[model samples]
Target: MTLNSGCRAEGKTILVTGASAGIGYFVAEQLAAEGADVALGCRDAAKADLAIQAIRVRVPAARLRSVRLDLADLSSLPATVDALDVERLDAVVLNAGILLSGPERRVNAQGHELMFATNHLGHFALVAHLAPMLAAAAHSRVITVGSFAARSELLDLDDLQSARDYRPKRTYGRSKLAQMLFGFELDRRLRARGADTASIIAHPGGALDSLTPSRPPLFVRTTAQRLRGLPAGVVLHGKHAGAQSIVRAILDTESTGGQLWGPRVFGLRGRPRRETPHAHMTDLEAADRLWAASVALTGVDPLVRPATPLRK
Candidate 1:
């Protein structure tokens, strides 16, 4: 279902990362169509232009701009924030991510494991840099896109950088789990600072169909799709149904500060609905550890006070 133009984001300014394609692209497009000024954050300037051009073609009046953002590079984050001229942001969507199968562990220039660096750490830095703008907005929201895979993983603070061992899929799951933990921790921290910003999490539930050669093997990815559904595609079990969940989370007033919204059907394919928090994700101690490591790794602290203490 398409989001109504009269929704909460109307007249607000939002920045969507990894908007060159997939759910990020759709989220930006939907937000723009609803009368929001959107900043499309992408790694490639040319691709970002193309994506913005596509959006303009469909919505000629769309108030959209493009910025270069590479989630793998922690240093590039501050520049991205500076490029956004607006003093405050109504919402920031940390949507850019990577899913790869590596035969051996790989590290980025920052000396971080490729999967964790790109998926979790990058976003961690971006949010910290944008924290001031978020706080300035006061009551603004931060919607992070996460996955169901986080349920199977636990945060290993001792090896957050993946120095000891690494399995591509498992590493990816760990990063996602970290993402959710950070989101929840952000909400708790905001409360401690008496800031009104809300941190919410949403998952697309695997309906994405677009592919690149570097992605997972055809049979494995395709099997996941078939098991999910046809019209929804393999990535999404139901056709664009995952989009509704995101839209609802972004606009739903009833949603609390740290809620997880998933699709309604099996594999989270249908309409949007509130889901129970993953058992592993409820560990506040892990969340606090992940937050501390994220701050040290990114060196961007937008919080006014120290992070909230985790429960035992």
Candidate 2:
């Protein structure tokens, strides 16, 4: 199918995290197919190579490469951010995340909650480090993948790190809220500085693996999932459908920063459309607080110049 005008990504250089599979993979593939130079971010080089190879088969002329990125580890971030060869970044899709089904609280290498670290803090660091490069490009955008969980519960500012009260579902919900908070606040800051970059949050509702495209062998669903059916949202949709909202956030020139895009019908399944976020998603006060905390934790200021030189 042909991409709509607002969804076209030709002549752009884009980076998609968690692109080894799932929503991220589809987003990267679609961007490449539309003539964007796509960079796939994966923790493992081999897996990245394979994903890019697969994309090339679908679009032989695709400009695709792999960039090593470990969201759960901060030490690896500096090198990864400095190593990106692209002088301009038209868009950055922060789509990598994890949902822990086990009833246990896990921490990352930094001793922070794993889901929160991977889903929010990791993207925060990446955006901070890449801000300079992004600002260099006209009308660049950072598309952060949020989730339905954000609207379900409010994050505890007193315990943003989940130190005392840590529950898997609550942590996941908080992570998504953090993403929205960061994205919104980043937009406000960029606007204040008159930077052309835009920060947009996109949520994909109920895109289950059963309805999604075929996965890499290792990520395929279990027998139970196939037999009982994948858990869906208010409506069941495929990964490709979910990716439309993300693509729109990146490509829609008319969409201003700080807007949340998601499924139109009950946020379950439908074409992407602008939707009012939970009251807290646009709370600038909370955003400021989150920004301060993120800066302290990540040690990378969004407006500061990169510590290292950019090399291609």
Candidate 3:
């Protein structure tokens, strides 16, 4: 769905991570078309440049910039925030991510498992670092892209890094679950702090598709994907339809501060719809535990106590 010229993002400054390709690229372009000053974040400088060029070509007057951001590396986040001047962000979309197909475990520079680090921890640190800026924007929002797979997975804090038993698919599911939990917890914290910022979550359903398949072996992956069916986007599903929901969440002033929006059909592919939080995911004890663990793992805290709490 196309955003009307009267869309609220006009004149807003927004940053979208992983804007080099796929849904991220389209989101950046759409935002630009709506008159948002956009910053496209990608791990590769060349890819980011190409995305920026493409957006400008699509909208000659598009206000867009490019920056380097490798979500696997926490150290790279500071530079990325500096490049975009986080203080000016009206919204920050965490869209960049990776999916693994095999059982081979990978570790990021920070020693966190690859899927968890990139999908959850990296974005965790990015938001934490930019929390002050988000707070400064008054009604600013932090939108995180999560997946419906989260509902099927259970949070195992003991194995959060996937150090004990490792399965690529399960690891990815856990990471997405962590993201959803974080979004919920962040909203609560923001409210407690009396900040106007909102924390929102979205999923692409299953619309992702490409003519060019992965290089390794198309047949194997294709078969696996086909067997996975709707969830994997092998068939028509709500992925892109969910994108519209994300757009709505970002622009709709009536939306509640913490909500999960996705496709309404089969929970996979369909138009965006408001979803009830998974009962397992809403536990305050779990949220608190995950928040504490994340703070220790990422070494970034959204809530930092001052030297003293001033008396009322």
Compared to the true structure, candidate 2 yields what TM-score? 0.91
Model 2 lDDT, full chain set: 0.82
In model 2, pairs of residues that clash are none
Candidate lDDT (C-alpha), each: 0.76, 0.82, 0.75
lDDT of each residue in 108-221, candidate 2, tens digit only: 877788888889988998887888789889899999899888888787888997889888888899998999888888888889998899889898877877776554442556
The prediction achieving the highest lDDT against the true structure is 2
Tell me each candidate's TM-score.
Answer: 0.87, 0.91, 0.86
Stretches of candidate 1 exceeding 4 Å from the true structure: 2-8, 210-239, 304-312
| Better-scoring candidate (TM-score), 1 or 2 | 2
The deviation in Å at residue 229 for candidate 1 is: 6.3
Candidate 2 residue runs with Cα over 4 Å from true position? 215-234, 306-312
Residue 167 of model 3: what lDDT? 91
Candidate with maximal TM-score? 2
